[model samples]
Target: MPAVDWRVTRLSRRRSTVTRAQVETVTGRALGLFGLVFGAQTVPIALVQADALLPGAGAALMAVLYGAIVGLAVATVTKVAVRTACLAFALLYALALVAWPFLVDDPAALHGAAPWLYYLCTVATTAAVVAVLPVWAAAYTIVVPAVYGVIRLLPSGGDAGPLLAVLDALYAVVLGVVVLVIVTMLRQTAGAVDAAQEAALERYDVAARLHANEIERVKVDALVHDSVLTTLLSAAAASTPEQQQLAARMARDAVQRLDEAGATGPRALDRVGLPVLVRRLRAALTTFTTPFTVRVVNAGGVELPVEAVEALYAAAVQAMVNSLQHADEPGLSTRRELRIRGVRAGGCVIEIADNGRGFAMDRVPAERLGLRVSIEERMANAGGMAHIESRIGHGTTVTVAWPQGAGGAA
Candidate 1:
């Protein structure tokens, strides 16, 4: 057999418990009241008919006591407890139904009203059996009446024919079948509902996984365009010995980044600190071909993951290169500034601004991946963001920040 799903099992059990409780609550109250009235009515009748203390009279009284005790006990206990009491009472009542015929000294009493006291208790016991032990209910229903019919046909029993005995027995048996069908239908409906809920939850989990994978794919595409390809192009364009050496160093860094992306080991980014990161970036900037001013403010002791620091450093370098290659004008002096500041909220921001002629943001071609992939998407992939502010005559400012809320330094 296949292993059972614990979720479905739990749901079925919970629903069964609620259904069992409802059955017990309704049956307990109804049966308890019925037993009290039946006992009151029959005790007096038995006393009058027997005219003196007798076994038959005593059995009638015991039936009443059994019914009242079981009924009241079912009302007070939990569903499982009620079920146990119901089964036990059903067995005891069945035995009493069989023995009541033998206990009676008067044969006429069996045919007349005295037998009804036993019949009433038997019917009530059958109902309790139906509520708790649904599978065995039909058997008990048939057996209770069959045993009574057999005794009525015996020599000691009242002069009753076979046909009359069977007809009386069939009435309660039919009622038991109807109760069984209704309970079975309800259980099937509950199972269907639990199955539907489990399927819906599984679908939601699958959809969420697919959406996350799509997002990660977009980030990887942007990183490849921004870092690896850009470094290779710079190496191809180098003319002087110093420029070639710088390009080779950048190429090595780019390859190492790619290797780290594919590695399964623990990430280097998890151990990077802001102070050490800033010192390395400052050293790299000293080799830039174009002269620029660098300033650090409140950046000491701040730290971040390697991914965030790498994004900021790479984007800042691209911004500086853009200024050196594209911002210079023929007849005007230009000033470039790279500022790194640690915010009070516990993350660092790098602003690369140039006081040189700038281009319109909206007019930039889609093929120019320098700004889109290198600066904007790189920061986005690192769980941070980049903003570019520029105008035709004013200047361009590329601001990259890792917000405190985006898993920055603790």
Candidate 2:
């Protein structure tokens, strides 16, 4: 599988988060609608009162001035459209309703402004503020209409005045209930949406982790199968002459021993000594190649952890392959050599060196997948280090080192 670039992955996740936020912002439809309704209602009141309502200015001057204010309010707060005559007419209608009662100065002119209709409209306006506006805005809207209605109805007090007050209270209660229901439902829906989004993100994270884990397991299995199994199979099928041959016979026996150990090799890390494991590695290397010396200089007197053992083994195998592949053999190239050294200070170090021509470190890119997966990553996971040193004519050395555990006292 191809590796994912972390920077690109992070950027994609960030873009998705931003898109979700924009969707949430647009969900406030009620607020935008209320702004349009209130702003449109301001227009016609300014229009008809333009002529007779000027205090000092002449009718023409007053008309133009009021028209400007209405136009400004409509343009800013409502959706403007040059083609929609119906919307313009609706604005004109609202203006006439608001201005007619004041301009005619007659109780009869208030007939179109039915008390029940006025109650519903004012309550709706108040509820709109409660639903979509800020606390102070809702208060201002409710207070203004309430005060005007009370002053108009109470001063003309009669037996019916109390009935009107009762009706107003009933309307207030109904509006309160409606607003409560609407707000509650909207809040619940918003909460559910947020929860669903959070769940999706969590699932994505889990899926990504699972896929990464499976890929790593596949890689480890492949490495062991290809290197360890191939060598052993050759040894098992060797002929009588090849059996006596050091290189051919050693290759065959290394595989057999490794297979036998494979049954208990893992347990060796937990219970066996580092000295035995290093000796086995040396024997395996000797089995496969002649004129290549395999020696353990120091074992550190410690048994490494399972992770560290696996890392050391893998690094040694890789080093043997490199020696076989690139050793400088002008004629027979029989002078090729390999060594394994173990040390104990704060930690155990497993070093593999070969007599082979090496390339410059910079010749290998950081993204070289084989080296990263095989050597670097394995040691790192075990809290260890894999260090490589080499020059053009000189051989290469690969060292895998990790701190000793409490039980493994080298």
Candidate 3:
């Protein structure tokens, strides 16, 4: 097994998190379907008023405008062309609104009814907001409705009085603003969530490194006392040639041990590869008194801090020891599992589960330090967390993860 490096580095990877882009994709799909359905509803209304439009080219123009909107909606939902489709829909709708007067066969054809284009102002605005920047979406939301309001007052338009046109414009603007605000809020919230998740992982990484330093200090101290001091005493007392030769060999071994623990190790922020951690863990598992069914799924290329690795390994061993001491039944055969798997951001999850007589977590006494202090507290100090799940006669599972919150890797 490769030696455990005492030096730990700052975490640079993130656990699985809810990102802004993920929320935006969902928002786009939803708005795309919204545009598609509402845009298609206006089609029957357009067909009914088709005669009022210019002959021959009127229906073709209607199809072109509606086709683009609906097709873009489909593309948006499929995620093949979201922003591009929304941009096309917004631009096409605005141009269509400008050409509405010319498309009419007669200026007075629709004596009182509002034009079909008036109903689609919000849909176009929705597309703009979903695809473009806030400034441009706001511009479209204001300009498109204002243009529609103008068309509503023209002879070629319904020629409705100013009151109704203003009311219609205000309603569209309000609706567009509401949609834009919702999209913006969702995006901001998702971004904050992503940030929080990253910050938490970083904190865990730092804590784990500190704990690793402490553990290493104690081990190095023990090595110096047991090996180096013993060798020095033997050298001082040696008189015979054979005894001196043994003392020289002992001193050499002590030097080699000190070298391994000295300042020549990895830097404080260097990554310990997952493969090395896995190798160490497997070696530790083989030392256990009780055999466990083990499964390993390596997360390729993940490198975590030395402290995180040490913390996870220590927690797993504690959990196994806990199971050996407690999980048992007189007449029942017990089975246990040890699963170590790679998680997001190069961290790992270690699960120790047993199908034996189990005890409730809440009932585990505060005085018992096996689960509370040695296992759970140790992991917490090391920037990881230990989770205990159990019920009487069902089983117990102690799940621990580095970078925090990566319990789902199992």
Model 2 agreement with the true structure over 271-311: per-residue lDDT tens digits:
22364455446546666745455444455445455456656
The residue-by-residue lDDT of candidate 3 on 40-131, one tens digit each, is 78888787667788786568867877788777768766666677788898898898889888888765557678888877777888889888
Quote the lDDT for 80 in model 1. Answer: 32
Cα lDDT over the full model 3: 0.78
lDDT of each: 0.63, 0.47, 0.78
The TM-score values for the models, in the order shown, are: 0.40, 0.32, 0.55
lDDT of 1 by residue, 1-410 (tens): 32224443443344222232234355555555555566566665555545232555555656555554556555434333444455556666666667665566666544443354444644454455544656567666667767767765654345567887676667656665665566556555644544454354335334434554565566667768988788888889999999899899988888887777655222221223354456556657778877767666665446565556667888888888888888888999899888887876358888889988998999999999999999888887777888889898888888888862333322
Off by over 4 Å in 3: 1-19, 59-63, 78-81, 107-111, 228-410
Query: So what's the TM-score on candidate 1?
Result: 0.40
> Which residue pairs clash within candidate 3?
8-268, 9-269, 208-382
Off by over 4 Å in 2: 1-27, 34-145, 154-173, 227-410
Model 3 deviation from native, Cα RMSD in Å: 17.7
lDDT, model 3, position 239 = 99
Better by lDDT, candidate 3 or 2: 3
lDDT winner, 1 or 3: 3
